[model samples]
Target: MRILTVVGARPQFVKAAAISRAVTAHDQSKGDLEDVIVHTGQHYDESMSRSFFDGLGIPEPRHNLGIGSTTHGRQTGLMMNALEDIIDLESPDVVVVHGDTNSTLAGALVATKRNLPLVHVEAGLRSFDRTMPEEVNRVLTDHVSDLLCCPSSTAVDNLEAEGIVDGVHLVGDVMYDVLLDDLATLDSMASPVDSLAVDPPYVVATIHRASTTDDPKRFDDIVHALTQVATTIAPVVWPVHPRTSDLVGGLTVPDSLHLIDPVSYHEMLLLVRGARTVVTDSGGLQKEAYWLETPCVTVRDTTEWTETIDAGWNSLTGTDPDRIFEAVDNSSAPETHPPLYGDGHSAGRIVELVRSLPH
Candidate 1:
């Protein structure tokens, strides 16, 4: 069986790593699986894109549709057009996509239009906020996917509530699968924070969502909150995103808050694993913090991964200074993190399910 896998962003690369390893093992044992990778150049920077491929040992993309940064509509349109051509050329048995980026939407649309089966990993996630582009992408992608590989029971419930019962499977999270497999390698990687001369017992903070960065006032407030948390609770190590850096130019950054360039995937895992508290707006980070048994203070009002909140591992603060400080000040991981996601075998299950489908 031949499968065309689509990924564009940093997070998708992490998700792809687990499944790629599974594909390799399947090919060696079964000798019938052939998978091709297609990279949409949504995240073009080496730190965000190429480094992840190198760090995770993901095979080089067979086709790179270089659709770099642009307006959402234009980017999606270009990806759909480019993918349509690739789909016709390769004509794989199935097209598999990950997460809720513009690339995911484009791949789903093209695959469905071409009458090819679509498999959406990380499906059935919902923030229930239509204003967020990711929420829209997730909802639409789930509706059209021929197989929905969900990470949690909560995600499966979300899909069932939407009346999407067909083709849904609780395959657990591919990210957790990678985390378990890569923890030793990540531990061996040198911590960037160690060289920065920052003290330990620090909080790791990251803010890069459009909802916060695109709005100057919101960005300012989040920065102010981090500053307070750094001074009052603990020092903060922030790996600033390029988008956030552009807006934060000329703004006063507190000494307690150490701003550093983004690190590789392994570096980030080490930093978060050792952090006293994690404050971020990134969806993946919330789960990472939870998995690492670190308390997380989310800087957003809503999160698609509500399981963390229910599990008492995550707290929402919504960019408010007082709330952010309070959440971080009282942050603590749950006594028992009842095994969420899966047991590091989700990728094998996903590949098996896709292989079972009729060509």
Candidate 2:
């Protein structure tokens, strides 16, 4: 069986590595699986894009559509066209997509229209807010997917509530798999701080999502909070996301805040591992910080990964200066917690499930 895998953003690229390794390893043993990777190029920055594959050891994509940024509808439409064209040519038995990016929604639509079976990794995640584009994408993609591979039992219950009874499997999180595999290599690499000129005992900050940084007022508020908090002993090491940097052009940064370009996944892992604390709006980073045993302050009102919150490792500060400062001041070292996302064998379990499926 051949699977067409689509990845468009940095997080998706990271998760895809697990699935890719699963397919490759399974094929090596069972000799019946083939995989093709397609890059939507939604995040086309050199460090953000190419470095992910290199850091994670994922194979190069078979096709790079090179569809950069645009309005939501336009970007999804362009991706649909490109993916449909590729599907027509490759005619794979299954099309696997990860997460709820525009790319995932586009790929699901294309595959469903073509009557190809669809598999959604990290499926059934719901913020229960229809206003969020990602929530809409998740709901739509889950509705269409032939196989829903979920990370947590909460996600499976979510699918059940939505009446998706069949083809729902709790196979844990692929990110956990990637996290386990990359941690060793990341530990071997030199710290990004030495190269980027950022000092240790720093708080790592990352802001990218539209809801957090798109609005000028909200962006300004976050920046102001960072400035206020910079007076503390430790500095802030912020590897700015390309999108957020563009939105906050020419904004003055506090001297204590070291703003650098986005680092590679391994570099990011190292930074997170060594950080005194992490403050971010990234969902992935929240979980990653938990895994790295770092205290995390999320600059958002809500998070899908409430496991981190329940474990006392993460706090939602919601872009409020007082909350941000308080959270930072009160942050504590993360105690080692059991994997809420699951044990680090999700990829292997998924591979076994795929192999057991009737052809």
The numbered model that scores best in lDDT is: 1
Candidate of highest TM-score: 1
Model 1 lDDT per residue over 1-359, tens place: 88999888888989888889999998998898888999998876765677788989988899999899899999999999999889888879999999999999999999999989999999999889899999999999999999999999999999999999999999899999989999889757888888878767899988888888888778888888888988787889999886677766676777888888877888898999889999999999999998999999999989999999999999888988889889988887677788898788999999999999899
Q: Estimate, for each residue in 1-359, the C-alpha lDDT of model 2 and write its tens digit.
A: 88899999999988889988888888888888888999999878876787888878888999999999998899999999999889888879888899989999999999899988888999888777787888899999999998899999999999999999899999899998989977778767898788757776788889998887778777778887777667674788888899887765687777788888889988888889988889898878988998889999999888788778888999988888888888988889755676688888898887776666555
Candidate 1 TM-score versus the reference = 0.97
Residue runs of model 2 more than 4 Å from their true location after superposition: 196-199, 247-249, 334-336
**What C-alpha RMSD separates each model from the true structure?**
1.1, 1.6
What C-alpha lDDT does candidate 1 achieve relative to the native structure? 0.90
- How many residue pairs clash in each candidate at the backbone level? 0, 0
